[model samples]
Target: MDAFSNVDSNNRGKRIIDGYTPEPYHMPWIGLLVKDGKARCTAFLVSKNANAKASVWVLSAKHCFNDVLFDEYEDKTINSTSYGLLFGVHDLRFSTQHVIYRTIDELFIYPDEGLKTKDIILIKLDRQIKFNSYINGLCLPDSTEEHTPYEDTPW
Candidate 1:
């Protein structure tokens, strides 16, 4: 049997909050530090493999790459590595061991009109990662609905 066979099928409430550690395979919660010298925001370092190949892509918000001015500049030049995702962050200092996945190609942004959500950014990894690690893949939502509403809400 496959390890993912019995994995959680529900996508809505399947979010996992992991403890920060020095482990390499562990998924570290990340934040973006602006280039003009600003603070960071709440973000997470996610990995995904759209293709079955060994290559993995890191996902984050496009705005996390730089300020909104770059969006108006028409020039696609932006600083990607300016922000660092500190692993095992307890009190701001880099406490736990963390691996900073380098950005291979230009960031890919998902274009959508009506949605106010942040644009999804993709950063390709230099090499392929193992099947099992702290950076595990997550299951996306399918066509099925499995969530229930509160008792007071109308069915």
Candidate 2:
């Protein structure tokens, strides 16, 4: 039973995530950080830069590369150039034909940043990512949806 019971599914209302994977290539902008050919963390393609052009900018949680297990590099530092991201893939255990791995040329994070607080970082791919049906950049939200009207988010 939903408030929009009267409303049909055709009328998309503030869509909610139900752990449902969208149609393949529907979210081709998403990528997984690959460590030794294994997926570790998640990353998403954003911005169109001249260097890498189509989705050159990769945004990910800074804590993903943290040295300490329990702490966010409170005692150590994060190896920015250690890991690489694998795009055009849905699963790591099984390799797909479109899986493309790109090394991390560099990573950017605040000097005094902490994991408990803001734990996000941006990475630059060693090479440009070719945009395809299963690999592309996502459009950064403009000023249209400023604030999420709902409170509970499962992202």
Candidate 3:
């Protein structure tokens, strides 16, 4: 038997009970510049994590990635490059202070309708991340869960 088994198990239980969740592995915002169906410019957010890989999905206007080119370009199709999400920003400076995962991979995109501007996107990190400070993951709203808003209204 391992001498630390008892102590290790107790520590694991405490971690869970205290709601210790993984922090956001990626920056909150990312910017992409699409010109002639290719990404040219990029932007990133603050608060970086250094010990893991991050994945980011591009959220853009429907016309950005969709096959809706105007005029004579209507028939042309734009396919994503293999590197796709794995590419990193060129101008963004990455260091121990403002770094989140070393790289990004496995990217996916979802297009939203016109009314809602369905621009929201979610992407998973290529690998697990470790942070210098404690971090908490954001909670997404569930469709089936009951939610109550102020003024006796549920949204």
Candidate 4:
């Protein structure tokens, strides 16, 4: 058993009930998806660009783009230029030298009507990311875990 052994069981794959802000770089894969300079949703780096040293692909929630709060964009085609990802920063309110913002080059969403249980979207950055201590990709799940039950899995 470790310090988080109890937390791990209680949380059941979710963050702490009342979580405190994590230190910078503690969760390097985390990202902030934004549109026109405002926050849209939270995202995470899933893989690195094949030809680049850092990650360029991120995963986010599909509802971020479909929510009634963002209805202004539902009728208009989503312009990649208007969206971006902010990586390597913990606090957006403060200016940070470690932050890196990348414009979105493309968005891949599974066309699910009514946006049911399939709530994921993949975003490609316009340029290759440069990895630092504060930015990196999360390890991808292996094929063996494909059939594992969600409740028993660790993200």
Question: For this target, which candidate reaches the highest TM-score against the unseen true structure?
Answer: 4
Find the candidate with the highest lDDT and give its number.
4
Per-residue CA lDDT of model 3 for 30-105, tens digit only, reads 4333333234323232223333333233333443334433233343223322112212222222212423422233
Q: How accurate is candidate 1 locally (lDDT)?
A: 0.38
lDDT of each: 0.38, 0.61, 0.31, 0.65
Question: What's the count of clashing pairs in each model shown?
Answer: 2, 0, 4, 0
Arrange candidates by TM-score, highest first: which order? 4, 2, 1, 3
TM-score for each model: 0.44, 0.66, 0.30, 0.70
Clashing pairs in 4: none
Comparing 1 and 4 by lDDT, which wins?
4
lDDT of 4 by residue, 10-109 (tens): 2123454554566567878788776656666778887633334577788888888774333454433367655677787676555467777777776777
**CA lDDT, candidate 2, residue 144:** 78
- Decide which is better by TM-score, 3 or 4: 4
Runs of candidate 1 with Cα error greater than 4 angstroms are: 1-39, 42-55, 66-77, 84-91, 112-115, 126-133, 145-155
Say which prediction, candidate 2 or candidate 4, comes out ahead on lDDT: 4
